[model samples]
Target: MPRAFADITFTDSVKAAQSLYGSRDANRGFELAEDGRHEIGPREAQFISARDSFYQATVGDNGWPYVQHRGGPAGFLKVLDERTIGYADFRGNVQYLSVGNLMGDERVSLILMDYANRRRLKIWGRARIVHEADEPELVARLEDPSYRAPVERGIVITVEAWDWNCPKHITPRYTVPEVEVMLEQLHAEIADLKAQLANR
Candidate 1:
């Protein structure tokens, strides 16, 4: 864990819980560590580019935390720079819970998962909502040309800190495309075996 991530996440209550659980000492090392991981690195960029979906959490005016799943084609979430990432907001159920929450509180947290690889990334950031009328070029940049969904707006996040979590207890789950690749390889092997049997 990076110091920046620790700084943002480790509250007094959290520390107290960690102390009760005997993990406080171990976690303190993270706070003292120098690596901040405030900017995206090459490995982070690659992982972020490959993710098709993420869970976004926002705080409502009533103080309730709202979590919503944001998804699109792989790479729909664009990394504008080392410190910025964004996505085009497609029309959904029209509840506008997330958008409304962002208007009230720009602070947001995101959890991106690679279930097949058993990897997860956590991001803390402030978000800005952009309308097409305001920044057409930016909205266009965030949108995926091949995706059929109609985008209503754009959400750009200024990354404050990010951290990769351990894979413990994360069940490996494969996407359809990943399974198809495995099946294709299996079929090729089966054909080769049949050819060998015929030769014999």
Candidate 2:
């Protein structure tokens, strides 16, 4: 866990809960660590680049949190730099709850999961909505030509902090491509076994 994450997330109530649970001592290390770990490193960049979808949570002016799932082709979410990441906001349900929430409050939280590997990353950041009319070049950079989706706008996140979560309860899941590769390996093994039987 990064100190920056602890700094941003470990509020008084959270610390109180930790103390109540007798885990306060263990959690103290994150606060005392010298490295802030605010910037994304190589490992974080690779993981973020590989994610096709992420769950974004935005708080509205009414104090309610709205969580939305944003997805596209693999690597649709671009790692603009160590401290920044963005995605082309494709036209989806016209409710536009997330966009509206961001208008009131810029603070956003994201959860990116690697279900097959049972790994997840949590990120906190401030998001800015960029319109094509305002910054066409910036919005264009986030679009994936092969995805074939109508770009509505661009959501750029200036990352504040991030932390990797332990994969304890995450059930392993596979995408179609991943399942196909596993099936192919199993078929090859079966073919090799049949050939050995034939030779015998």
Candidate 3:
């Protein structure tokens, strides 16, 4: 756990739980995070760039938490800089719950998952919505020319800290593209086997 993440997550209540669970170490967490697991370096930037979808969480004025799934072509989330990331928020069901929640609180949490690779990344950041009128250049940078999803605004998330989760028991799930490649290899093997039998 990075200090940035651990700092916010390791509250007294959480510490009590850790004690109850028989884990009595906090230094290791901080030490490992300091060893370069917490910063948004090139590795993190590349990981975030390849993700097609991510789940964003926000707290509402009513104190309720909401998680919204944001998706686009691979690399929908744009890394503006080492510490900044933004994405074009497309129009959805029009509930506007996320926007409303962000209005009350700028704090945001994001989880980007690569199910096929059994990898997950957690990011803590403060986010603000930027309108086209307010930031046309940013909007253009994040927009996908091929994706026809009508973008309402852009959600700019400024990274405070990020952490990578352990890939324990994360069941591998294949996308259609992945399955197609597997099937192609199977067909090629069958053709090779048939040719060998004919030669015999």
Sort order, TM-score high to low: 1, 2, 3
- Per-model lDDT: 0.95, 0.94, 0.88
Best-fitting candidate, scored by lDDT: 1
Residues 134-169, model 2: lDDT tens digits:
999999999999988899999999999999999999
- By lDDT rank, best first, the candidates go 1, 2, 3
Output the lDDT of residue 18, model 3.
81
Give the poorly placed runs of model 3, Cα more than 4 Å off.
26-28, 31-33, 36-38
- Against the correct fold, how does model 3 do in TM-score? 0.93
- TM-score against truth, every candidate: 0.98, 0.97, 0.93
Backbone clashes, each candidate: 0, 0, 0
Better of 1 and 3 by TM-score: 1
Whichever of 2 and 3 has more TM-score, that candidate is: 2
Top of the candidates by TM-score: 1
Candidate 3 lDDT over residue span 83-130, tens digit each: 899999988888999999999999999999999999999999999999
Write candidate 1's Cα lDDT for 1-104 as tens digits. Answer: 45788999899999999999999999988898878988999999999999999999999999999999999999998999999999999999999999999999
Which residue pairs come into collision in candidate 3? none
Q: What is the C-alpha RMSD of each candidate to the true structure, in Å?
A: 1.2, 1.4, 1.9
Better of 1 and 3 by lDDT: 1
